[model samples]
Target chain A: MELLMAVSIGVLTACGIYLMLRARTFPVVMGLMMLGYAVNLFLFSMGRLATEAPAVIGRAETHADPLPQALVLTAIVIGFAMTAYVVILIIRGRKTLEHDYVDDRVNERDHGVAEQGLSKRAVAMPETPASAEADGEPRP
Target chain B: MSSHLLILPVLLPLLAGAVLLLFSGARLAWKRPINLAACVALLVVAVLLLLRATEGGAQVYVLGDWVAPFGIVLVLDRLSALMLVITAVLAIPVTLAMSAGTDRTGQNFHGLLQFQLMGLNGAFLTGDLFNLFVFFEILLIASYALLVFGGGRARVAASMHYVILNLFGSALFIIAVGLLYGVTGTLNMADMAVRIAALPAEDVALVRAAGLLLLVVFALKAALLPLGMWLPAAYASAAAPIAALFAIMSKVGLYAIFRVHGLLFGDMAGPLAGLGQSLVWWLALATMLLGILGVLGARDLRTLLAWQVIVSVGTLLAGWSLGTPEAWTAALFYMVHSTWMTAALFLIAGVVVARRGEARDSFMVDARIASPVVGLAFLAGAVALAGIPPLSGFVGKALLLQAAGFSGDMTIFWVLMLCSGLAGLLAFSRAGTSLFWRGPVAEVAAEQPPMPLMPALLLLVLSVLLVAGGGPILDYLAATADAMLQPADMIRAVLGDRYLPGGA
Candidate 1:
């Protein structure tokens, strides 16, 4: 049982690393989810696998260690929340930047949208031609 | 006050945040006062806790009247109290600055800030590893929302990377905790320490692996050399006040290293002694060098300040990795100074960016700053950050150098530290000249809005106070270090006298 659990963890981790190395945000998120699952499983297996054992103190001399079970449950919930957040963020990135690539250089072209938003709220001042020229675009 | 006063730092923020969330639709005027009042109260509580902690000994508060190893416990000592005080000090300026128009850009800013504080305080005080992870998640989630609070595409992109990296770190953290618990059968740090100390020789390998994993997780959080790729862009893109608050976030990782390593694995003859310290020492040197390079190569002021943050972390850890009482004392002093100085620099950068609309704090641009006062603030911050004499940074660096003098690799530390200081000086001078001196007069002469200068000024004043009160501050830090070096007292307080190896 321990061997099986360890092999399963190793496979999940390998797959997660492979996916995480991809250049796209969606795959990265998927990789993160896989890694999260691997970690949760690893945490659960830390108590060592137990079959037909009471979770609480009872007549049986052997009982499953419940602490890791409790910890893994908490980790799973936090991981779920984080995954949801990342998905929403990726969706927003896709809509605004029009791409899903994780590379910053690839996303640089769409920075004008971000800068325009910043200028609108942050500065509260009119734009100058010099700044526009710096952006390598004609003044709007 | 009862010993229960210790929990108020965490509970007050939790309650205030929940209340603020319920009143999210209330007018800013109404919510502002409440948030401000809460911050002031937090500061008072922090100060009180610091005073109480300084009176001597570790104070342990167990939940539900359960014994230490079985129940959740919060340990308040000088180090934790000092962290709380610094957090509270930073909170005041950040909360006030948020009120000055930054909060309106996002929903639930006040609530998130309070939640973030609760997480930070809890993380500082919690004695259980699992509880630490829980508080870390709370703080990271709140930080994620706060990072992108003032919506910008840059912030969104940066927050994405920040969230993903930290999520990975959190996973590793739990894995490490699980491995440790699997071996020790306990989650309370003090209990775990006692177990690990008494472990059989055959299990050393597993314990070492767990300890290494824990260090790797902390390195990621602390932004140490190879794992620090996410910090610069993420910090540069954050809103100023949030960025200021985050000055303490990386320190949280360092704090974990100090507390966990100092308490559990500090003994020179222990199984896991010096397991990862040598690696940490080299990594810290590399982090310092890379951070200085980043500071030099930065395109804008905020990014430069972000790199400066990394550099400061590297410096502190380099001293801390030596694992001496003097080194820890110096590192503690540096921690206090760096937190205040970096926060001030970020705030000043915001003001500079606001004043120079067309240039927007970009070193390549040539628009002059409108306010001389802002320029002077920037100059003071730059000087302090560069570790020039008479400021808090200089005092901290001097103490660090003196502490490093005791180690065998003293020359390497001195060379790297001095070279980094020189590199920072050159970079800041060049950036300063291009920014304030060489820039052309603006054609528009735009009127500066009433940007809240008070918070920035207050932070700068705090930096000055660090310098002016250096003697007393160093004395206090020495005492803090003395208490920290003797972690057995803390363990004894939490786990009772019987847990001590030879029992009293």
Candidate 2:
């Protein structure tokens, strides 16, 4: 049972990492979600596996670890809160910047320029004149 | 009485915040009155608890009347009670300095502040790992809201990064706790300590792995070197009062690191050998070097102060890693002094930003309004933060250096201590020149009201007094540090000495 759990976490982590490195915001979000799932499962498994058992000891007693279960439940709720928040933020990013890609270099550079007392407009150094035309092109 | 002391620190602020939330309508402004009362009450409780600890040893309060290894517990000893007092002293001033008319982020500003106090108090007192996670979440969520309170794009963007990094850290933290529980078959700290100690040397590697996870998670939270990327950006973008509050939040990370390292992991020291101390020392050195460079490069005054916080973290780690009574004394002194000065520095920055305008680094204040109060406040804060003599910061750093020197690891000690001190001084000097020395614009210079000098003055004086009256306080703190390093008192306070090797 422990071996199965370890294998499950390993696979979850690989998938999570792969998705996290994607170019788009949605995929990255999904990757983070996967990572969260993997983490929760991994943490829960630390309490050891219980077979056909209630955590409480009684007539039908096969003792299980309740602490990890309780903790993971809290994690799930917190994870949901975080996911919802990040998703909304991504949507806002798309609306304002008019791009769905997770490349926030444009925003970060602009902020840095602003902090340096330079004009944001002046700091908007286009990579290429052709890219400037591409910048106006709408994404699906 | 001792057991009851555990509930008061956390519960009082929570009740106040709840009431404030309920009475949000009308021009009541009840938050201030309630918060002030709660802070004073917390301070009193902390002092009484400290006294009680000195007289009677450690105090453990089990929640729901359940015994250890079964139910939740809150432990208060020299370390915790001392931290609680420092937290309260720092908090009350920030609470008083909060401007009611101000809109900090989108949340009900004062309500979240009180809730943060609740979380901080709880974190300091909790004896269980799961409860620690709960308090951490509470603190971070409230911090996120406070960080973005101004609705600025930068703050909002920074909040996103802060939230993500912390969520990742939390996931790591919980996983480590789960692993420890699985191996030890218990979540109670004292119970786990005994079980881990009983394990043979060959089987302790698993415990070390778990300990490493916890260390990483906490280092991230404390903004230690490699894992600290999110801090300066996030902290610099937040409002002043909120940033001040975060000064203490960062310390919570160190608090956990000390507890986990000294208590649970310390028992297994035989197997790990010098591995634990070495890991901490290496990290501390990296953190110190990186933080100083970061401060030197920081252009904005607030960002400079933010980097100073990271440097302070290095000092904390270095002191704790020394693993000696003298070193612990130094660490404790630094913790108390740093928390105060950091909070004051941030608040003073806020006063400057408020006068100069919202463009942050570029605002020009009117001489009339910014001259007397705000300018002097900034100057005092700058001097105190730089660890100039006759202030709490100087005394704290001196003790830290003394301890490091005592360890005879003089190379790391001299390099980190001198560099951190120089970086801190240069950062504050630049800020002071920009803020107080520079003349204000002609137009608003006439209209400017005298700066609110009282708060910063009070903070500086208190710091000075702490230094002046250091003899007794130093003795008390040193003894507390001695007690923490030994852990016999702590263990006895939790589970009696019957579980000890030579049963008392």
Candidate 3:
């Protein structure tokens, strides 16, 4: 049983790392979720992987370690929330930049041109590059 | 003061944040004053706690009346109290800055700020490793929202990277905690320390692996070299007040290292001796040098300040990895100094950006800013950040150098620290001259909105006070370092005599 769990964890980690190194936002987010799952499993297995054991005391002669279960449960909840937040952020990024690439320099260059074009205003607020691209105007 | 007062700093912020979330739709004018009042109250409570900690040795608070090693515990000692005071001090200026129009750009700014505070305060006080992980997630999630608050594409990109990187770090953190718990059969740090001390020799390798994993997690948060790639752009893109508040975030990671390493792994003869110390020492030096290079190459003031934050972390960790009480004391003093100075510099960068308008704090632009007050504030902040004499930075650096002299590798640290200071001086001078001296005269009579001078000025004043009150502060930090070096008091306070060989 321990060998099976260890092999599964190894595979999950390897897959997560491969996806996380991708350039696109979607793959990175997916990678993060996979990694989160791998970590949760690793944390769960830390209690030595008991079968047919009770979670609470007074139920069985030998009970499973409840602490790692509790810890992994908490981690899963937090990981789910973080994954949701990151998904929303990436969707917003795609909407604004019209691309899913997580490159800051490209975004900054486009945003900088927008700011320069709107320099007449005091704030010089950043504009969506998709709109600029739609207008077919060359950025400064 | 009741002993239960130890929980107030964390609880107050949690309650205030929940209340503020309910009032998120209220007018900014209404929410602003309440947030300011809560920050002031937190500051007062922090100061009182600091005083109480100075009088007492270590205060432990148990949840649900469960004994230590089984229940959650909040340990308050000199180190946690100092961290709390610094967090509170930082909160005041940052809250003021947010109120000065930055908060209007985002939703739930006040509530997120309060939640961030709760996370920081709780992270500093929690004795259980898992609890620390929980607080870390809370603060980090709040930071992510705050980072992308203004909804700029650049911010989105930066926040995504920051969030992803930190999420990885968090995953590693939980893995490490699990390994530690598996080995020790306990999650309480004090109890784990006792267990690790008694572990059989054959299990040392497993314990060392867990320890190294924890170090990697911390080094990521502390922005140590080879793991700090996300800091500069992420910090530069955030709103000014949020960036300033983040000045303490990296320090929280350093504090964890100091606390865990000092308490659980201090004995040199132990199995985990020399585990990651030499690696930390060299990485710290490299982080300092590379960060200074980043400062020199930065195109804008905010990015420069971001790189400077990395440099400051490097300097603090370099001193801390020496493993001497005096070195820890100096590191503690430098921690306080760098937090305020970097925060002040970030606030001043915002002021500069506001005045420069289209130039947007870019050093390549030559727009003249006519505010004498701002120019003076920039001058003071720049000088202090570069470790010039008569400021707190100078005092902190001197203390660090003195402490380094006692270590065997004094030459390397001295050369790197002085050279980094020189490099910082040159960068700040070049940037200052280009921004202030070489700019064209103001021609347009356009009326500018009033700059947020109060928070920046307050931070500057606090930096000056650090210089003026160096004597007493150093003495206090020295005592704090002494208490940190002796972790038995903390263990006893938390576990009573249960972990000790002979009980009362």
Give DockQ for candidates 1 onward, in order.
Answer: 0.54, 0.40, 0.61
Candidate 1 scores a C-alpha RMSD against the true structure in Å of 6.1
> Given candidate 3, what's the lDDT at residue B179?
88
Q: Estimate each model's TM-score.
A: 0.92, 0.89, 0.93
What tens-digit string does per-residue lDDT give for candidate 3 at B290-310? 998998898888899899999
Using lDDT, rank the candidates from best to worst: 3, 1, 2
Give interface RMSD, per candidate. 1.1, 2.3, 1.0
Best candidate per lDDT, number?
Answer: 3
For residue B12, give model 3's deviation from the true position in Å: 0.8
User: Which of the predicted structures, 2 or 3, would earn the higher lDDT when compared with the native?
Assistant: 3
lDDT of 3 at A113: 56
A25 in model 1: Cα distance from truth in Å?
Answer: 1.5
- Answer with 2 or 3, whichever has the higher DockQ: 3
Residues B146-251 of candidate 2 have per-residue lDDT tens digits of 8877666567566766776787787778778877887887777777777777866666877778888888998888888788888888888887777888889899
Best DockQ among the predictions, by candidate number: 3
Off by more than 4 A, model 2: A21-25, A84-140, B1-3, B26-28, B103-105, B273-275, B362-370, B406-408, B442-451
Better of 1 and 2 by DockQ: 1
Give the TM-score (vs. native) of candidate 3. Answer: 0.93
Name the runs in model 1 displaced over 4 angstroms.
A59-61, A107-140, B406-408, B441-450
